[model samples]
Target: MFRTVTRVELSELDMPRADLAEALKCCLKKVRKGHYIIKSNCPNSHVDTIRHLLREPGITFPTFRGDIRDDAEKLRMSIATRRDSLLPEDAFSHMSAALLHGLDPVEVGTERVEVTRPAYSRAYSDLLFYARDLAEDDVDHTLGYPVTTLDRTLADIALDHPLEVSVPLISEGLRERHINRESLLPRLAPGRRGRKRALLALELASELHESGAEAYCAVKFHRHGITGMTPQVTAYSSTGAFIGRNDFRHEKALVVVEVHGVGKYYMHPDGPNAAARQNHQRNMNLVNAGFKVFNLTFGDLFRPKIFEQIKWAITQALEHENH
Candidate 1:
């Protein structure tokens, strides 16, 4: 969202008049002197006089040096005339707005801007505006400028980005555990007419399990008639701090299961390796204190080998529980 100048105030310091003019003049040269301090193309000399006129309407800078006030009215007036330009997208600037809005998934580079145009549009050949066709629902507004909502942003990313790129972003949200799922739902265009694949993509995106991995494991678990196992369940510490809610929890046994994804081995900037390592140390401490830990990777989660392994582990834990 964009912010507008909601209010203004004036203050005075015991600084000398020449030094004050020099400082204010620098502010004027850098940005507009009004309500919003936007970048300006004004000279230093004229800026000081404008600052003086702001303090007192009839005051001239060379003649009126006593307790001069900055001009609030003229500053506000300069920006008020350019109200239409005060959009959030304006802050993003050029192709940056497109990536920020989710019209496209762009590489997060320092200076390279990325944008997308309509499928039929002519290519501009500008290195900055790397264009692509927009899905109808992807185009929307934030504070009256074009941008995509969070859901659409993620969906677009899923469709366009590789697992190495996408997983890190998703893992960051999950590891921090502060993803705003409710607000993100609106941006998902669920049906065929709109962003048809987005809802499914979102569900897939949240899955920590590799594709088809959990399904394979679940089938074997069900076939064995594992009475105590629950899939897609929540987990908590003894303190009930809700640490890493899991894929499965055997309530009777107090054991948590996680179905790890493929990227677990990859070293991304926000890779699961670091998070998993930290979790492993904590989980070891829990096990040392007589808690149960059950983890399965993409290799294990999808394999028949994992079912036998888990069956063994559960049997051993159940024996300990009886003791």
Candidate 2:
């Protein structure tokens, strides 16, 4: 999340203290809200002075305050600052639109504000222009800033990035019901520069994926020629009792792969120890029901050695079944 600071425009300043005003004028960095700047680099004396002023009554700050670590929020602030500079017909597109629409960009950076213009394409220090005309249906302003529609944004990103980078966003759009697969297909039609990769991404995309991590894991599985896995599969006991829904299931090998963050157990409402106990019980149930469960963390998915082990495990299971 990116931090937002309360700003009083330099032109609107009515300072009773000359020293404070002088310090602010000298050290304040320019942001859309005015001369409000982060205090990270300011001298301790200046920071103290600014802190005192901020404490004064009737000096309310905007909702966004302090350090911002959220990428989406940071991009939003970037868009807000640059909104005034955009032409009336221009709208934020591609990755910028993706972020605005609440879709993750995966491996892409959010530093540059991508805008689509009716005229020429160009790149600037902190801005990128996609030269293309947008239909009335392709633009939206519900976010308080002009941006490409959800379908348009996904298509644009799909057309510009690789499968690994684009599939997660597409899957998220589908998962969230913001855009359907059919509406986005046309934009990635044949003869487009990245149509092949884009189409593959669309084919691999699944709304059943609960998170971008699962969608990405699907892509990785495909790339590794492991195509038998299905997302969000339910396991059942021989007597038809319900077992939990697993993240990915390979029926032929009787393997269930679960992708999750380490914090899941720790952050559960029931507490980490209880969560771990529940997880262990579930794993035992799946095993007893003739399923091999593999718990994978986000970090595990990225390690080649881990994938190699998974492949070997699945292969062994398949061979055993054959015998």
Candidate 3:
């Protein structure tokens, strides 16, 4: 394939002298000082430059993907590289590699730098280095050129992380529609370390359990006998007008159950009550429009008192159902 070549010419280009020189270097060989022809398999950077110069007002060239990455592709690859250092050669079949490939805000914070290798030393209390070989292909990349894959990521996390940690991550993936049980199951080789747990986690996962809190609330709500509540629900009026979306809603009782935390609710830097004011207004609008809105806080959901609050909210919505 490298035998056949594409020919291009260069002259007084609409660029600086240094740029003109660089353009000349993009060619396979200079036909003369002012003209040149480039090989089809020329480095992408060179080919891209030639393509750009030739592809002006009337000039057209067939688009071909070359060894050089476009600016956007370069950016993606750069990020992917920084995220994971394992090259294609290493047998990086390990969980740390998986984490590096799929590290998000939930798994590790933005500033957290992971150095995954088969070494362990407690340098910093915040930093952790797992003592395991990074098996090649143990993970897939977040970007196209990345080493680890998401399926590998799920399996590894499921195997290595605690149930509390892994379930939330898997739940978020399922709830956000980025992953599915069927796709992940096939990726798990028989006798894989985390296959059983991963399969169980996927089976119990639902798109409605958006957050760890939400996922926990779902199970607890059911245990508390709170039926008919749909998670991450959108409510609409009888006339099809848009009512605000509820974290959980029961259509039969016209009840909207929502959880609140400092992060989920947006607040202006100017004042403490800014988010409260906006939220209150929306809740009041729903109430006036004939929906019983129950605002549940983290405390309300996690504590023993959650049962009473659930009963009260359901009773209120049910009693006002006739209205």
Top candidate by lDDT: 2
Best by TM-score, which number?
A: 2
Candidate 2 lDDT, 1-323, residue by residue in tens: 22224444332343335545655576443454352444234454545544544554444222333423255545555665666578889999988888777676545554778999999999877688988879999999897779999999888888887776688888888888657888998887678888888888889988998887888888888877776899988889999998899999986888999887556687899998898898888899999998878888777767777666677788999999889
Clashing pairs in 1: 34-75, 34-76, 54-71, 55-69
Model 3: lowest-lDDT 10 consecutive positions: 1-10
Error of model 3, residue 22, in angstroms: 53
Off by over 4 Å in 1: 1-211, 264-269, 285-289, 302-305
Q: Which is the winner by TM-score between candidate 2 and candidate 3?
A: 2
* Residue runs of model 3 more than 4 Å from their true location after superposition: 1-136, 140-148, 159-163, 174-177, 187-200, 203-212, 222-227, 238-240, 267-272, 311-323
Q: How close to the true structure is residue 107 of candidate 3, measured as C-alpha lDDT? A: 28
Worst-scoring 10-residue span by lDDT in model 1 = 60-69
Between candidates 2 and 3, the one scoring higher on lDDT is 2
Clashes of each: 4, 5, 14
lDDT of 1 by residue, 1-323 (tens): 11222113222323345643564455422233333331233355434433433443332121111311122222223323244443333222222443343221112322222334443223323222323445555555653445444444454444444432333343334334345556455545455233443343343334343233444344446555554666566555566655555566676776666666544446445677676786687577556545567677655544667667667778888888799
Query: What lDDT score belongs to each candidate, Candidate 1 first?
Result: 0.44, 0.74, 0.53
Whole-model lDDT for model 1 versus the true structure?
0.44
